[model samples]
Target: MTGIDPAVRHLTRTAAQMRKKKPMRIMLLAHSYWPEHSPPQRRWTTLIREFRKAGWDIDVVTPVAHFPQGRRRLPRSEAGTPFRGQRGPFGERIKRVPYLRHSGNRHAARLVDQVFSAAMSIPTALMWRKADVVIATAPSLPILVAGYLVARLRGVPLVVEMRDAWPDLARDARLVKGQVKSVVERVVEAIQRRADLVVTVTDGFAQTLRARGVKNVVTVTNGLDLEAVQLLEAPPAERDKLEVLYLGNHGESQRLDVIVKASALVGGDLMHLHMVGHGTRRPDLLKLAGALNAPVTFHPPLYGADLIARYRSADTCVVSLRDDWKSFETTIPSKTYEVLAIGRHMTAIVRGEAARIVTEAGGGDVVAWKPEAVAELWAELARDRGRLTAGLSGRDWVKANADFRQLAVQYMGHLSDLVVAGRSRP
Candidate 1:
């Protein structure tokens, strides 16, 4: 043992310490899981893989994969299996429950599906062996409720991971109003109160939860998976016409119609706008773009190598948010991180945290919904293409701060602390 290299010795000691205590079994409750192409699934999948590698026994409970497009993706043979258990990546066990499939881009329809999935997940979770800690990933309220119930029943600490602000986001988007908004706010508050720890994707979100009187909130911002980062090819050669890409969900919150309007403002032979992804608002956006004679081309979503290729092919990526919506101010779109990781220039049409990061990093220009301003920025970029390739401080910042391994370590430490504290209580 003494002959072992110092680094190896340190690693052995760390592994032994991790094994000194019985392996912690962590149950993750998420409405969407592996085989789904959504951001939340990607984030959790990477984290779960890391947790497993670190010797934690991680079990996942999720509905059959269906997201963004809202069509069930299970194999025909597995479609009828209401409650099926199978080994997932990294030796983690996964429980798939039946859920009502609905378009995730539509708020009301997605909420209905979430409720049904949550209902089915509760019983499935209760039947599982007790976990040391339960983590509920939520942009959906029902999943949080189910997680709370399972944690309570299992007598374990509950950790609520907020991917979005839920009721607050809905209310800001005007999707929930009047008495419905009041009720949702109350329910969200109640859910937060039940959580032994709250994990959020943004510091802004953590602050919002703290203001609502929820204690023990931690920010674990979305990060780039290093393995995926390594797979990205170098940015492709500049295209004949500057290809400006907007890749992500075309939901109401995204206010992608603003992009259409901006496209109309900048109609020229030298610029082309590519809008990729599916959403409830895609038809509306398409119709508006056609009516305005905007130079925008719409494409279905791409994943894996295809998506990375799309990024490489673009000179700039556009990210937008509804300017009037306060709830979105807290959001740092995962695409922003992706673009930075790929070292592509970006145009952030947003406010608050997202804008601050872009501005501070000098990643790209930040513009409002003003069509003229957006057009001006695009024209400027078109004239000075060098601006797109100049500074890479943003990419470097993300690589240094938002690496997945670093984020996973931070997340695991939080979970470990929570588990230890829970064990010490009573």
Candidate 2:
């Protein structure tokens, strides 16, 4: 008995044929792009670059840069005149759409940025010509709306890639309410329905979209680029003490307080939790660590090779998703993949699909966002070094399956089929 899903088998066969004849020509629209330093931007970079390598002529429509580094990427300056345009390594054109500001904690600020980026994309995509396909990547749902309209105008097929679910996620988080949120959700749903193909990051999310009436959805798990990750050397373990590292943003959604509480509960050389990253909640988390006298170390963001090396210092990698159920179906922290790439056992203190990934990958253990549970797990792992080492077998599982190369190939195959179908249509 062949265990492959029929839909996937068919799509795979179709994509293989499309690749041999001619590579795809694709225009990807996202609010952020490479060097902006967000997980979504990182994912797009890997996929787009891989597609370009496979002979896809790619063009990325994105906003002017400014992100996790907290600095505006100045337009390239040559002598006195600024270099207004730059193309990606594989000759993919980069079209910078004007945007208002960087990320923000305030809804108004976030809306302003999202709207500006989307508005800028309208002209950007309209003026960009000769692409066989357009992919609207999301979280900024406005981009999907713009992609759909542009594709409709150009008579091209529009593919929507959902990185996060919108208004409902916002509603569940109590970020907004009343008529406006209701309206935004309806708009998002309409766009989802209109897209010819929808790419979801997880099966759980796809299921949610299905229940909400979205059709033609496919799951593409977030994965690590082991090629780049290999540049990082695993650090030598320091001692008998367990070093649990949490890498990525220290924002509110992480529910890091639980980790702090858990550490306080354990309170010994047996456990040490290090959080490495910058976020709005860092100061508060730092203060809480001090007040609680938890054995927590805070480090600033590290980039690429350096970041990987820094992460190697830990015996186990840790990630915490928000305790909010609203987050379960909508988000999967990309750090989980990074942890696997680094060959570290993961300790995820949250719920939903991420927990499932950890469990299935044999990557690590999952516990509810409870101090006692987290502490118990920490103590158990800390006492059992051999177990932690054995648990890292999941890293091998991820490398073979969830690594970026495999993911990129899958994505390009899907995009190729969409392009072929678009080209075939009357």
Candidate 1 — what's its lDDT? 0.81
State the lDDT of candidate 1 residue by residue for 61-179, as single tens digits.
88877765576766834332568787776788888888776655667788888899899989999998889999998887889899999999889999998888766787787777899
Model 2: residues >4 Å from true position, as ranges?
1-19, 69-83, 102-107, 231-240, 327-330, 390-392
Cα RMSD (Å) per model? Answer: 3.4, 4.2
lDDT of each: 0.81, 0.74
lDDT of 2 by residue, 98-139 (tens): 666645545567667778778878777788775888888887
What TM-score fits each model? Answer: 0.92, 0.88
lDDT of 1 at 232: 37
Candidate 2: pairs in clash: none
